[model samples]
Target: MLDKLSLVVTAPEIVLLVMACVIALVDLGVKSRLRGLTYWLTLGTLAVVAFAAADMAMDGRTFYAFGRMVVSDPMGNWLKCFAAIAMMITLVYGRPYAADREMLRGGEMFTLALFALLGMFVMISASNFLVIYLGLELMTLSSYALVALRRDNEVATEAAMKYFVLGAMASGFLLYGMSMLYGATGSLDIDEVFAAIGSGRINHQVLVFGLVFIVAGLGFKLGAAPFHMWIPDVYHGAPTAITLMIGSAPELAAFAIAIRLLVEGMIPLAIDWQQMLMVLSVASLLVGNLAAIAQSNLKRMLAYSTIAQMGFVVLGLSAGVVNGTTANAQFAYSASMFYIVTYVLTTLGAFGIILLLAREGFESDEIADLAGLNQRSPLYAGIMAVCMFSLAGVPPLVGFYAKLLVLQALVASGQALYIGLAIFAVIASLIGAFYYLRVVKVMYFDSPITATTVSAPADVRAVLSLNGALVLILGILPGGLMALCAEAVVRTLAT
Candidate 1:
């Protein structure tokens, strides 16, 4: 029922979708030698979308379009902009790696990635539960194909199958929850459901029952513990280029959906979801850190670390409402937004380095593969060290500030349990720091596994350096971005 005017809010998504289709068609006429056209076209599409999102966010436009099924707001727009830019950077860092591994035999990677980005756009802006699920499926399906792009690789195929099965189960869980909520409230629209709950007196047992399933589904998507069995195998078995594509940008979308579903739609039931989130957070922190310590593979270790880092993000979410007050909701969620954004930024740099170092017949996935990196390429070694330190929550890095703000939100709650959780988070972080430092030590102290000179495309090197500098710069002066996040959360939540 959406006409052009009614759907204006989805302009960025429309452009990207059209671009993806056009690129797919054009790819057929181009030869392999000219496949770089597909890459360039994809980059142009991303640039246009990201620019549009940024401009919209800067203008502070908020729109509810297509009969209120979707929204255009600063928070959604900024997240979309970040996702597009992340995809652009991922493509730049990944092209050479994909080419080396023959994963670029066609233009599927570019088109599929574009489609995945489209999915993220929808997920970010969706105001309907059905829309969110549609977007999630689109993204996950594209990711499945991307992971198995190396169709001949048995491991890649195996990982793809596992991802598909697990993703299906998670989707089922989410859909079932939605059905339960619909049965209770008789609405699929998030706002309508919120209003339905608000009109009621107290707790709805049926809603609470649905909440558990929804949290389980969200936990799987976020890669939190007990539901995180897919992350390590997928990250390890997929091509590193594919891993970068799957890991970095989708996280921002995941965070956006969490805000939409939990904060926007179900704040009335925070007491219930918060308890579940706390358990997931603690489990993720303990399992992610402990499991990571045992992994020799860099990608797998990062997978586990992702679980732990996402735990911090979840921890921030858990602190949003305290003592039946929404007073701290904005701050807690804003802190989580800042944390995920910075974490994604840091992750882009870390994984970009791994892709650059990878050569044909060598995955460069093992931690020992990075030995003597400083001797070979001090620039890269330094970049990797910065990322490792940031992930470990070392001071004067953005990650530390992210954790500090989240912990501050918890402390401000004056809740003994939250305060204890904060202390536990610190201790877990301390335990996790050892593995991160080990990577740095290997880069600095250990001898090379091979004496090959490390090199990357000029653009990859330039973007990576900028990414590192941004993390450090943001850490030094976290005001602008922090303020931006707080403002976005305040405005969106107020609406």
Candidate 2:
């Protein structure tokens, strides 16, 4: 049984769920191609939700709600706040493109996005295995529909089918692992599972077997290598707006769940999981960077780039526990948090530009499409360049600082193996830089395919500018956000 207090802990999710339902009903009357009324209402709902989540995070309190099925804490609240804001920006940048492509004919995109964001909220707050699976399914299902929203397009339909099949397989892996753990531990609550494992009385071999399956499932969700087959196809075949929607904020939720399941629930098995994560990290970097270089399709290239970036995140996670001691846990986990947040920020800007360039009859999704962008619209060109440079780990941008933090975490462990991993990550990053710089060079030096200036809706322009500026500004003064991540992780770990 739940109480009013439990509902209070999930107030933001409640408001979101209610507003999403209302907007869906209200959109039935929306005749505008842009779904203006639905859009504004959705943004308003998200704004309120984000603000409320931030306020709750500032309280720095932790509450176990719904019989410990969910949690409300600084880390979860902050992630919810960021996810909400990211969805709002996605809508702003995507509305025009959706209108151009007739993808907003039913306002389903907006409603589905809200639902997906709500799913992220649930995942961030989950403290039980069932709750986490429920949230993951909710988010992933909405994404599948969104990918298939353009029903007339064979490419989108194919992408949706592929995503559905692979995602289902991955979910099964996760559930099987959870069942194994539950059978061994006699409990599904994360804390209880941790207690059971730490007691040193469980079947170690069974735990290890379950852990292998769990990591594989998580690797698929995070788009890490050896399990990344779905990403490039999905990103390339989906509408650009949906691609951005899929690419950006859900990552924060994934990172949150990873921390909850692995670090919080299974730290006693650190030695085993860390080794698994190390291998994933190495494979992701090598495969992602190498594959991205051969890609001429911008979306597919970015998809592979995403895998490599996730590798850095996994690196940070693998370094959290050293020699069975939790001394560096906070710093290591916080570094991963910082990296994912900044990566999401940079991704939004990069994909925003892609959405802007795509016209009614033109996809504009190839590297060649960006040729001579500077000659037509320097503002957008500069924004795109900033994003490319940031992704390349260029200095004075947020990406450099992000990579630096992860490397610092690795080196802080003072282990030769981690140090070797860090060195390998750097080499992979350097290889990745070549492809990223190639995009910049084409934008600046290649001949123009069109002399017309890029035009965007006023809202999109303003949001895109703000998005790009934040990447640069955050790079220059990253201390504030870095400290915020550290504090959130500290509070989360304390509970």
Candidate 3:
């Protein structure tokens, strides 16, 4: 039996689970005004979990918990740490928006956020299809509730409906894929499945079909082109706080799942899936960049940008090639992971600024709404500029390094055609820059529409400033995080 008492292997999950239950119980017993307590408690839980993950990384163990499930290897530990940090930052950015709108006391949202974190923990460590599905469902269900948290808002209601419908369909696809793989491999364990493929015991047709379905399901989750019809509408309709969570946490989870499925479980089938990802990557880049240029709503623009970023990650993954004896895939996989981290940080920072600028009645979602921001608040404008430039992949910014790594990985893999496509993507990026820069130009160059000062709550302003600074700092010193990402992917591929 799997011992539940191991701290080194289970500390992060156990701490989060215990805190989630405590917060739910305390929320029920406490007064309505005291609901903010749950939020802080949730953040504290994540902090502890993150620290525990870091410690586990230091120890460097791969398998834990009676070897039935759960692993605390560098890969899972690092990804979980990143997910935890992202959750805490999101809570910091979300608190003021919830409070200003009298929505602070929603203990369910806080609890659900913790549950989603738990899902992320399970996702990164999952050794079997059952664990992966369980983790994915836990995260998806919690998100559905979060998106619909503002029950009175019709847009929220509609968006929740769309998310629920599409999310459920995606889950079905994942399940069907799992079933096919199990039939062909005769095992649910990822290691066993990989062994079957490596030994040529698995039927080729079944493996390819199952993989296609799995890719399709994950593509929906990542909001890649041709599967991204729901992103903009949902981003526009969901509350800013909920959008922040969706934009950051879920994207990380999707990336983790992709790494687990493609890099770990299906490495033997690289030639088949890499081509599929390449086509999807190119489509996502073209569609996301072109579509985003027309968006006036800031949240929608970011949603489309998220699609573009996913394309870049896919581009890296698709650069993998099979050699005679071993797969030459490490560079692409590492590049994809690094891009995910950078994209998550940049997107969250941009959305954090949106949450900061939003007032009680005004949402700060529209681009025209940011006109003359510099005159009203130069500090906020400057922070927003950093986010904008970073998103545009400008030099000396983290986003630039991320894109550079991805293109370099593709070129090194001898995929020169993909390199050409990436160059075209750079042009698309410049075209996409016009919209992001339009926001910056309005902030720094335009005249103020009103004389009233744009004031954010103290906590909101602090987080926004820190988030913006971190993006620039990471851009300047990306080597450390990039090295960590390389280590994680190397460890995963080693297995």
Instruction: Evaluate residue 133 in candidate 2 and report its C-alpha lDDT on the 0 to 100 scale.
Output: 96
> Quick one: ranking by TM-score, best first?
2, 1, 3
Per-candidate local distance difference test: 0.92, 0.94, 0.82
* lDDT of each residue in 1-495, candidate 2, tens digit only: 679979999999999899989999999999988899999999999999999999999999999999999999999999999999999999999998889888989989989999999999999999999999999999999999999999999999999999999999999999999999999999999999999999999999999999999999999999988899999999999999999999999999999999999988999999999999999999999999999999999999999999999999999999999988898899899999999999999999999999999963598999999999999999999999999999999999999999999999999999899899989999999999999999999999999998888998899999999999999999999999999999999999999
What value of lDDT does candidate 3 attain over all alpha carbons? Answer: 0.82
**Weakest lDDT window of 10 consecutive positions for candidate 1:** 1-10
**Candidate number of the best TM-score:** 2
lDDT of 3 by residue, 259-322 (tens): 7787678878988888888888888988888888899899998888888878998888877664
RMSD of 1: 1.2
Q: Encode model 1's per-residue lDDT on 240-317: one tens digit a residue.
A: 999999999999999999999999999989998999999999999999999999999999999999999999999999
Against the true structure, candidate 2 has what lDDT? Answer: 0.94
TM-scores of all models? 0.98, 0.99, 0.96
Off by over 4 Å in 2: none
Candidate 3 stretches greater than 4 Å from native: 4-7, 32-34, 64-67, 322-328
Each candidate: RMSD to true structure?
1.2, 0.7, 1.7
Show the lowest summed lDDT stretch of 10 residues, model 2. Answer: 354-363
Model 1 pairs whose backbones collide:
none
